[model samples]
Target: MKSNLAYLHSYKQRLAFISVSVAIIALSIYFNFFQKTENPEFSKLTFSETKTEILPLNIAKFNPNTLSTEEWKALGFSEKQVATILKYKEIVGGAFTSKNQLKKCYAISEEKFSQLEAYILLTDEAGKKQNFKQNKWVKKELIISGKFNPDLYSEADWVKMGFSERQAAGILKYKNYLGGSFVSKEKFKECYMINEENYAKMSPFLLLPSKTPADFNPYKKNYAKEKRIIKYQNFDPNLLDFEAWKKLGFSDKQVQNILNYKERFLKGSFKTLDDVSRCYMISPEKFEEMKPFIKLNPDNFAVNNVVNSNVEMPKQKTDFAKIDLNKITFQQLKEFGFSDRAAASYLAFRKKLGGFSTKDQILKTYNIDKELTQKLIQMSTLSPLIAEK
Candidate 1:
């Protein structure tokens, strides 16, 4: 009876072992082949072939004007299809004038257009007309029917000539910086606030000379024979008074003009040597002569100050603590001396990437400079938790 019991226990152990082995084999087969084959996307396709497969579409109401490149792709459009739509919009002017215009694109077939028709939103005709009128490039009717000197036109006068209040103020401000008058039509045209179309319409009525006189030397009292004596010494252009500028060979009028520019246009200080160089009254030759003597304070040479300036300034040395790239804020970036535009751009790119996994990825941000890139790399740290995700 004891022998019979022993044999039964031994047979049960062997059966149990075989059952476990079979279960393991079945699981391995499922994982290695059956599991992958169950999903059509993973089955029987090369990498290149998989890439050609269409991504699922997400349809929603969208304005073509505000829709981004990625948003277009999300709406079931192929890369070529998205590019064609964008190109058509660009060719016709920067935006689609109407929903019908977008529907007419070659990439957008009638069937596709039908699918998107209910979701398309565009500006009304009245709104478009208002936008067209507000465009600076659009030619306005001539309010001043006869010849008039733009130099003498007051802010109100400029408004009467069809310029907006803001544009009129800009013109007047620029005119004040140029010694209360425009020397020539070409110089007047150089105002950044005025577009080519507006200038062309106003050109025929402007009474100023078409070009400045070759002999007209703005820095000197007499261009014929008088040579003003100048004393050169190390000086900060930002700190110079009217007397100091006159002492540096500038005429009294030129000195007053420079002071006016420094106080008004530059908000009472020169941020860079380039700002001093750009004074409208300072002739190029005069600036070159005094360039060596100008010394700006070292503290004024911040990264933001020199980014747009032609003058090169050394970046201030800083030891930044490592920061998680995924968690950095726009205000934090601004504290590092980034412009509003650059900071916004960095944030937008980071959002598009989900989150950065490495320091090198920050380099791909639009408008980021090499110096900023190096600083970013030095200060970046990826969160381990984020990396796993």
Candidate 2:
């Protein structure tokens, strides 16, 4: 009986050992060949890149004042730029009439102005209004045959030669803007409205002198000399009528600009010599010649009319006697009797500088007159304050 029990136990132990060995073999086979495994090089895979292309502008001739928002976009103006144009027009009462005026818009860049300059056109009414003229610019039927001198041609002459009223006026205005004569036909081509085709057509009729005088200076001094002796003895720009301004060597366009500048500011009047020079139409040499004759009251001139602008003149008391120009704030500048344009300019100038080191540097401020500089020096002490301090 003992031998039989021992035999049974030995058989059962062998069977259990075989079952454990078969289970180990199956697990090893499954792990080695059938179970799923992750890829090691997955992170190193590359993808095709996508690229963007810039589209060229589709430009066309259109009046900027009347150009729709869509038209402005087609002409390459961004939405922000288009909004700026509309806002500017709304503030200024109408569209731009001249390249100089257009450039004065804060949003318009020099490059953008140059690109769109050729397409700008002022309506007849707008042109006449800006030129300060009441007479209709065009008076005759079309007759496009003539060899005419630009300097000598009248509006009637221009109209007879196929130029529109606005084009004729722009040519005349450009000539006068040069103070009455162009130095060369090439100079005449600089007119914004004078395209290559118009220039080519008018080149044959240009009356440029065959020989420039040996002493001929291109500064327009010779042309200015031919005008009636400047009768502006101690004239006040603040009180002068439009005709009186014209008598002071200001062209019609220039007179309009002066009046516009005066009306655009709070006081709407010239406070210093630098103010006169700020007008784009007035050259430095011209300003110097007229400086001694300029007269302004010690008190600010009161203008009845005020053209609206975006810059809000904050009411702040800035005692010039206690102010430092190098450390002046934008609001303080306005309080110091600077126009909004001039005040903004001062802030920009100071931001670019590492503080002012000398009294002479104050003159470098935009539209700051020598008289104003002298006043500032008397009123406030010039300190050597560095930017970091």
Candidate 3:
């Protein structure tokens, strides 16, 4: 009995020792809780006595479909929105055509394009776009023979195709505008969609073509889709020599003017037929007649009325015109308080990005202001193009 009692006493001593040790350990952990911050992003947190909660850019980027609520929060996606996105991804079987297409996801608002932009793995978008672009198809090549053979595109072919001699010459000269150099019949077809039968007729010698699996028209994708939507900026004032315009009710003169202006201006919009007619020396009566027949750009239209209208209030004038938004020299934009670098950036974006869509688009630039954009627009309005005869 004495031995058992001694053993129990020893066990009690050992338990007491362990209890005290555990209490010490617990206190240590509690006192130094802030020391647990060890992430690289948290390294800077030490600089301040008050710790900052730093968000880390995951080394392995998050997949929106599989992201947890916490991860979604990092991307500014609410829990409900994240769940909806996942459900949508499941519906499409994990196939996203493009990041742009993701905007169609009911849960992802168009406003989210920038919010979740960081988390999006554009590998899928880029891969899909590349696949579409590099897609192969059988095509026809139309090599014209005879007088136009030097260019391998003949005036007779153009005329038979319903193209006038001048229009034919324009087509030849417009080769770069059409598609630089044709690799497949499908591409050339787009440039000559107006005369498909004529293109098909000459297409035999132009060569019935095919694309290899690796083939792609690099420059073909450079132009925007809306560029070829219509015939021309100015329509001929007389009558459309072809049936498309006749069936459509546009006269040749109107069609010619539209074509001439579109080619001349480069930018697609015509504020009024006067812009085109004035360039061609056409009368106001003829201009007004051609107005209804002419199509002004629905989305993009401009008038150069934004000028110095201070005919009387020379001193009271406040400048509001867009500095020849297209040709505003970098040096001048700076005087208007635009930093040289930022002004340069705007210039480059405008040139490479087709054309100035709206003053709002420019205002949304990284460092520009809404007020300044308004001022800029009022200063320089877009001009109508005059064809070089």
Candidate 4:
């Protein structure tokens, strides 16, 4: 009987423990299941509601690079404008640091930048802020030597100087290169033809529109000869249209002269009535003089053939330039002998973060197979100038 009581007491103790566990679990459920959910400290809002309430006229004060395409459209930017900015970024480097610096951006308008200045973050990789800055100084002038022709100059008095004809002609030619009509005093000193002595002598009251004579052309006509026609006549000069010149009793030499002059002097046949009227033969002064006699039977006009004669075959640039792996496009990566799959992997890895800055920067982007990165390190691409022109 004593043993039976001991066993029964142990059994009751075990049951009580199990009962207590169940009661604790039931109370936990009652508190948790019946309780109200707590409110979150902050909540996300829909873009439309946020824009309507938050934007106001201050929409102009945002940074465009950070905006979504929808947000860009809200500010009156077209898809093309956005695309231009992206393409310019790819070609010329990335976005401007601030709204004012956005002047370097190709397509964003002044009005649009004003609208977008408010939202710009202008942060670098380290999270440091950026601001607008400009370089205000002018570039220093350059000096170069060249040759020229004197008859091309407006004035003839330049011949009085003891300078060689070639030297004077070269000075004039240099002026032409700069798009200046006449030689500059500052430029003359730049060429060193006018030393301190000559510069002092010539710097006083200048008389220009002075004539500088041209070298006699071996090709120029002898105006003294009857064979040398002093003036041109209004006429069609095609050998194909000999009858037209013959009707005016034009000599064979005269006709030959006219045809040769047409080939040598004109760029092309009449593109329009105005173009035909510009020709020396058909010029306004001459066209009006010859309008009564002018005739046109040929339906087809000649194209500008002189351009073909003068065209220099472009020297084929050697493809000696190496591609920079860090900066290269996916297409460029493939060109460097990366298989399409490997190239695609590199792009995907870079796209997740930003692109690599150096060949070593590739290691920071995840999922790049270690073996592949190691293999790429064995070789490197160089800039075009570094490899060859």
Candidate 5:
């Protein structure tokens, strides 16, 4: 009976020991996972909430190289996260060249990267052939059938013209960087992704002009004797009558067109010699021939009195003070006797060049005449900073 009692006691002790072991394991698990820690940086989110935070709600195929900050935000990254991603890209040569490279960014956790893995489009050794095949299939499906103006095309329009979405985005980004439009087919072809095959396929359908106006040579063909014989005379184009224009070697039709253009566009009289040069009927060679003889005096209205009484005479400002070209304002330019168009042109050109380095640079401005250019050089001085630069 004593032995039986001892056996019962031993069995009870073993059961108690097993129960304590189980309890200890349960407590360890609770402390490791469920219990709040001393670490303030540790997230207290539940497993489901943690999953929600890591995985983006929206998933779409996107090139990491072209994603803007807002686009990254749209993909569920915080501002700081997006900044980190962009900094990573900049450190790695301004673009994410591969999905694996993007996955290495610390801003994107392993879970997040795994979630985004399939949606990331990048050209890498492993995927290059597949992407090429996919792009080929896309091009075959979307054939460019009709003529299209690249200047007017948007990113979507370029995609429809057989360019991949990424290529279209790149084209548009380059176009915007080049003041929002491609000037010529050659300029469009200069895009980094545009290959000779692509350019050849698209060139015939591109509705852009064959050559820029500056590149076109009117004298390429031999001119007739009568067309070549232009009389040189000092005359204001604004004051010239139809007979006077005819005497200048223009045909009757060309003379009438010039007169009508002046009446319709110029509000009766030309404001500057540049206006006269801009007449569509006048060729570049013809304008160059007449440029020296085309005298435009805004202050003198004796010709206006004889021709049209409705013409308003511009105020004359003969006295001038030497001004700083770098500090000159648009109003100051106008006060210094520059026409509104000329003043605007100078400012625009100045902006494009990031301020002129030399007085001769002013001569490079479009619509500015030699007379005005000379006056500008005589009256203006460059800032010390600009001169030193």
Candidate 6:
């Protein structure tokens, strides 16, 4: 009977221990997850909202075109303002040539421009050109000699070569943003700061490539390396988003130029690989590198073309009298009033069906109509190149 009493007492202690353990576990769960739901202040203690830090503005003489994004922020502009300025410069094809040009940026307030105007250093070439146009100054030539590669020269080197601090900084900034080294002297000349006189002075000392001057076209050859044939990726530039473009190794500036060209020049369309090739900013090598990957869609092209057109007819229809439809690229289709996407679509269709036997086949293409096909038939001819292909 005494043993039975001891066993009962031990059983009670075990039950008490189990109850305490369950209570502790329940409390732990309540604090871990349920506490956040039950207690708002506890949730706040765990996670804080993210805040953007604004930099203090420094008032100094600065070139809006040349300033890095960080430098713009340091000068008191917000991150958004900096991005706007950069985009403005990019759309306008790099660098503000005049004080008035800087004023045109939407982000720049009158008060801000006024405060920064005194500090802004206009390139000597630009200043002189504007002055000459205004009858305020005459231009002259300066001659000098030194061994220098303008592409490789630092800001200090430019300063030693008689450029002002601001001019030197502008040149370096421009080169840095260009994404690659200058392949020729002509490219360096395109700098807003570098005028004919300055170029003449620097030309003798500048190290040039071994190729004949005739061989180096600045617009076509932006890279220093020889062109290598690369296998094309299956993609379409017209349909590519920003991230996709960046993935293709295009510079930010180049990508922006493509977007700008689409909106402004091409009327929000691309008509051909040729149209893309015509973007002088894209070097021949780069275009060739991309030629394989660009897939064109015609339906998208047709819709945009119809929507964007103000005139009764496309402007390039008259120009295609001599162009062979079979021989021409989809870019040529753009001449026949097709949007880039439409042109590409036609080209893609032609490839898939082996070749167009008649203009009637075009009606089967997405977004292509009988009247447009007839007009294309009237405008185009079969070329020997088409037969070969």
RMSD of 5: 15.4
C-alpha lDDT of all candidate models, in order = 0.66, 0.62, 0.50, 0.45, 0.67, 0.62
Q: Residues 1-389, candidate 1, lDDT per residue (tens digit)? A: 99999999999999999999999999999898887777857756665432333334655556676667898888888899999988987887766656666777999877777777677665333433333546555534334455788876766567667777688889977775565677789878988778875675566568999997775544443332233355577987765656767777778656765655554445456878788877656767678877888888855433433222332222232323546767777776665556677788778888877777677777767655435556555655666225212
lDDT of 2 by residue, 108-161 (tens): 777777766776653232333333258644432223233556787655456556
Q: How many residue pairs clash per model? A: 0, 1, 39, 23, 0, 8
CA RMSD (A), model 3: 23.1
lDDT of 4: 0.45
Order of the predicted models by TM-score, top scorer first: 5, 2, 6, 1, 3, 4
lDDT of 4 by residue, 1-389 (tens): 99999999999999999999999999898766654234232244335532321234644434444456677666666798867776765564444443344556768755555555545544222222333357443321111111233334321224334454455556655554434433334444554444554343343323333333354222232222322432335443222354455454456544443343334334334333444453322324334544554444344344544323322222232121334554556665543334566577677766554545455656543334334355444444423212111
TM-score of each: 0.24, 0.27, 0.19, 0.18, 0.29, 0.26
Regions of model 3 farther than 4 Å from truth: 1-60, 95-97, 124-389
Worst 10 residues of 5 by lDDT: 311-320
lDDT of 6 by residue, 1-389 (tens): 99999999999999999999999999999888786778768645665786544333655555454468888877778899989998998786665555777788999887777767777754444453434456565443222333667776655456555576678788976665444466556666678888764664455456865334666544344443323322347875667656566666677656755565455456656778887886635767678777877887764563644433331222233344555666666655554446565677777777777676765666666544334556556656654325224
Task: For residue 350, give model 5's deviation from the true position in Å.
Answer: 11
- The number of the candidate with the highest TM-score is 5
For residue 313, give model 1's deviation from the true position in Å.
Answer: 19
Reference-based TM-score, model 4? 0.18
Kindly report which residue stretches of model 5 are placed more than 4 angstroms away from their true locations once superposed. 1-61, 65-104, 109-236, 240-275, 278-311, 317-327, 334-357, 360-389
lDDT of 3: 0.50
RMSD of each: 27.9, 22.4, 23.1, 29.7, 15.4, 27.0
Point out where model 1 deviates above 4 Å. Answer: 1-319, 367-371, 379-389
Say what the RMSD of model 4 is.
29.7
